[model samples]
Target: MTGKLDAAFGFHETALRLRSERQGVLASNIANADTPNYKARDFDFARALQQATGSADPAAAAATPAPALARTAPAHIATGAAGTLVAGNAPLLYRTGTQGGVDGNSVDMEVERNAFTDNAVRYEASVTLINTQIKNMLTAIQG
Candidate 1:
C-alpha cells in the first residue's frame, strides 16, 4: 500500500519536500540580511528535483553535482550557505553578481524577496498537485 501510494503520487512528493527545504534556506537568507559576511545561498530547483526523483538522464545528473559537506564534530551541525540547517542533499550555491555590502554581507533584499516569492508559489503548486492526486485516488477507490 505504501509502495502503491508512492507510485501514485510520483515525484511531486519529493518536489514538495525539496521546496519546503528551499523555503527555509531562502527565509534564512532574508532573516540574516544584516548579518556581516553572511552569503546568500540557494539551490537549483530543477536540478535538485531531478536528483531527488532519481532521474536516469545523464545530462540532468551532470548539470548540478551535489557536494558532500563533512561535519568536523558530532555536535557540529550541517549548515547551509546562510549558516542555517538546511537538511538535504541539494547543493547550496552562493548568490553571485550581487553587490556585496560594505560589511561583507551578500544578501540582497530585492533578490531574496523575489526568490522567496517564487519558491512559495512553486511550493503551493506542488501541494495543490498532491491534493488533486489524492482526491482522484479517493474517488477511484469509492467508485
Candidate 2:
C-alpha cells in the first residue's frame, strides 16, 4: 500500500538526517584539529536513533532534559567530566587523549581516520537500504 511506502520513506528520511548531522560533527572535529583549546565532539548514534524514533520510551520526550552547554574553560579537567556534558541526545563529547599534546589538542589522527571510515560505511549502508526499500515498493506497485 501507499501507506507502507510512506512509512519506509519516513524512516529513510530520518536516517539520512542523522547521518548528515553526524558527518558534519566529524568533519568539524577534523577541521579544528589544529585550533588551540578546540575539543573533539561526537554523538552516540544508537541511543540518539532510539530516542528519535521513540523506541526506548514514549514518555522520554517529556522527561528528557536540555543538553548542557560546552564549557570553554574550567578550573580543572577531571576524569568523566565529558561524559555528563553532551550537547544533545547525541552522546557526543570532547575526548581527552591518553597522551597529552603540547598544545592541549587531543585529536588523534588514527582514531579520527577510523571513525570517519566507519561512519562512511554506515552511511552507505543506510543509502543502500533505502534504495532497496524503494525498489521493493515499486515492484509491488507494478506487479
Put down candidate 2 lDDT per residue, 2-43, tens digits, no spaces: 797677587667667777787887887888888887777777
Model 2 steric clash total? 1
> lDDT of all predictions, in order shown?
0.78, 0.71
- Model 2 TM-score (2 dp): 0.73
Assess the local accuracy of residue 128 in candidate 1 as a C-alpha lDDT between 0 and 100. Answer: 88
- Candidate 1 per-residue lDDT, tens place, 5-72, comes to 77877677777888888998899999999998888888877767766676747785568555556677
Clashing pairs in 1: none
Instruction: Please list the residue runs of candidate 1 whose C-alpha ends up more than 4 Å from where it truly belongs after superposition.
Output: 56-88
Error of 1 at 71 (Å): 6.7
- Each prediction's total of clashing residue pairs, residues at least 3 apart in sequence or on different chains, is 0, 1
